[model samples]
Target: MSSPVRYAYYSIAASVLTLGLKFGAWTLTGSVGLLSDATESLVNLAAGMLALWALLVAVQPADDGHAYGHGKAEYFSSGAEGVLIIVAAGGIVWAAVGRFLDPQPLDRLGLGLVMALAASAVNWFTARGMLRAARRYDSITLEADARHLMTDVWTSAGLVAGLAVLLVAPPSWAVLDPIIAVVMAANIVVTGVGLVRRSLGGLMDKALPEDEMRAIHEAIRAVAGQGALYHGLRTRKSGPRRFVDFHLLVPGATSVARAHTLCDAVELSIVSRLPGTLVTIHVEPEEEPASFDGHAVGGACAGGGDCGSCPGAAD
Candidate 1:
């Protein structure tokens, strides 16, 4: 698989290209809407730089001080990008408000529209590639960057369409320039907030998605065999890596070698189902009353009763 840093570099390159194109458009036409588009491309440039740094940090191997690895560094990159996006939106709104109070005639709008369209085309292709890489690598940082680029593309498209309307309408319709800028700002704010929320969730060590959890359960249950049970299943993800820990219950008469073999099998099954997963299994004899003590995810089952009542039974 290609490293995320490669894709991050792709984003940075695209941002630089689009940023120049957009600023050129803004300069040519003196349109607030075009200025708003340029502002977002500036944010994209900063965000891409941050993503590159974060991806470099996140790839570092686990050290003595950080046993879990530096994967959570990715969350910081995405969160910081989100903040930059919102700040850029605020700047756009401020510019739009100024233009609203004192409207100005747009100059050379036809050439400006052409430049904006070219920038949007570059962003559209770059975002698509980044999005595909994100899905393949399960990298949140890449996904955030790609989404922001796509937002910029849409914003540019909207501004182009609105400016086109102004070109044909009366000079009185010049107010649409600021109005379109405000609308574009609102559209990007939504994307910014979404990225912020997702980044926060990742930093908080949120559980894996439902489908991944279901796959884990299926893997465990397949290796558990008849009469054996499991409990206290817990899961979390850090960047592209998933972590799972659980308790496996079996008859007291099961030999130590057999238990070790079963634990190995269960771990293999889970790792197969979800690549890049780290699994820890605690083996406990089912006859032990203390084994059923629920501490994390699964419910406790009192000793000498049917294990079917345990929360893990359903899983």
Candidate 2:
């Protein structure tokens, strides 16, 4: 397995442990807020397992069926996680509402608070590690998993606060517990929507960022020289890989071998500048001569012929 797969496995194990601890704590305390936290952990458990599967599939080499590779599986995995989070949030809201209508006597508030605080600390460290790994590898699935854990951290913290309020104040303040649960559910819903939006963009094959497109255009132009123009620039990202394809228009007389070499050089340069890039260059003949007036020109041959007095052409 690759490093990404290994990291995902560790994440899944950690999430499972967290789920068990949170559920146990909720059972002991009978706190609605702790139950909400536990429910989110259940979602995290599912998301983490899916992310591990995605990581494994994503790292697989491209085959005949998936010529562009299996990296896009990460997007699907993250999107599913987002949907699960929304569902978990809905469940939390329902539970909180029920508790509001029929408030339960929460016991061992101090113990519940301590357990939640410990869980929060564990989530904080684990989430940070997951995020750092995801950023380093540019793995969207891992990043999404980390975000789920981070949400758990916040919810757990909120649970602690609610428990504290309930313990210090009289029974009249029991409403605070359910209220905090509702607020946490609302936050989770927002995160779920954002994740789903990102997933849709990836699945739709949205164009790469403007800055990335511009950088690629510049890279191609740097090598193609005057009278050469690039078009049909398209780009998309999946997991950690960036897929780029474009058309490069060159002089009609340019040999196939030379054009292939130029494309190779440009691809290499781009890959060096940006990691995990797969480039495809389509060579097209320029139909019209390019103007040189007021624009800086490079490698333009005189007399409109090759092997002549070109400004930057090799002898």
Candidate 3:
């Protein structure tokens, strides 16, 4: 088993532990806010399992059927987690509304708060560790799990603080329980929507971030040195991997071996700058008018001396 998959196991174990604590707290106190926290923990458990599966699939080597590898599996895990979170949020809102309609007196506030605090501590430590691992491995599944765990920690803390206020206030403020749950639900919905959007962007092959794109350009320029131009630059990311494609224009008199060597230097530079990056360079003779025919972004232009239609113009 890989290190990242082991982190997923830790996440699952933490989820189970936190879920037990939070659920016990909710049962003892009958606080809707605690109930919401417990519900999100349930979602966390499901997400961790899904993330484990995704990591397993994502780490698989490329095969004949999947020439690009299985990296996109991580996106499916995150997207499903997002959907589960939204569904859990809906359940929370429903429970909160019912609680608001028929208020109930909370019990064993001291014990319930202690349990919630304990659960939050577990999640805090687990999330911190998973976050570090996620950064080290560049695993989206681990990052999503870590971020969701952090959200649960914050939610539990907020619930504890709200219920503590109830311990000192009048019974009329019991409505605050449901109010806090509703607020927690809203926050979860926002997180869910954001995750879903990011997943869709990944599935849609969204371009690499500007900083990485700039790095690619800089690498090419440094390696190609003088009397060279490049265009039709494109880039995208899949899980931990990055893909970069561009056309490198060298002098027409340059030999094929020299052009090939230039391409190798450019690829090495880019990979050094951005690890896990796969660069594909199309070598073209600078003096040939046909070399500028097919630009990736805006297609061919009528007058093609780096016109507005060319992506290189903007670069």
Highest TM-score against the true fold, candidate: 3
217-290 per-residue lDDT for model 1 (tens digits): 77877787544567666678888899988778888999999999989998999999999999998888888877
Error of 1 at 313 (Å): 14
TM-score for candidate 3: 0.94
lDDT of 2 at 6: 81
For this target, which candidate reaches the highest lDDT against the unseen true structure?
1
Model 3, residue 229: what's the lDDT?
68
What's the candidate order when arranged by decreasing TM-score?
A: 3, 1, 2
lDDT of 3 by residue, 140-231 (tens): 88888899899888887888888899989998999999999999999999888888988988999887776776677678778776435677
Question: For model 2, how big is the CA root-mean-square deviation?
Answer: 7.6
lDDT of the structure predicted as candidate 2: 0.79
Q: How far does residue 158 in candidate 3 sit from its true spot (Å)?
A: 1.2
Q: Point out where model 3 deviates above 4 Å.
A: 294-308, 311-315
> Clash number for model 3?
0
Q: Per-residue lDDT for 1-315 in model 2, tens only?
A: 698888777777777777777887888889888998989988888898899899989999999999888999999999999999999999999999999998877888787777777777877888899899999999989899898899889878866876787777888888888899999999999989888888888998876676776666666656665445555556788778898876566678989999999999889877866778999877767654332211122211222222223222332
Q: Which stretch of 10 consecutive residues in model 2 shows the poorest summed lDDT?
A: 293-302
| Candidate 1 overall lDDT versus native | 0.87
Clash count per candidate: 0, 0, 0
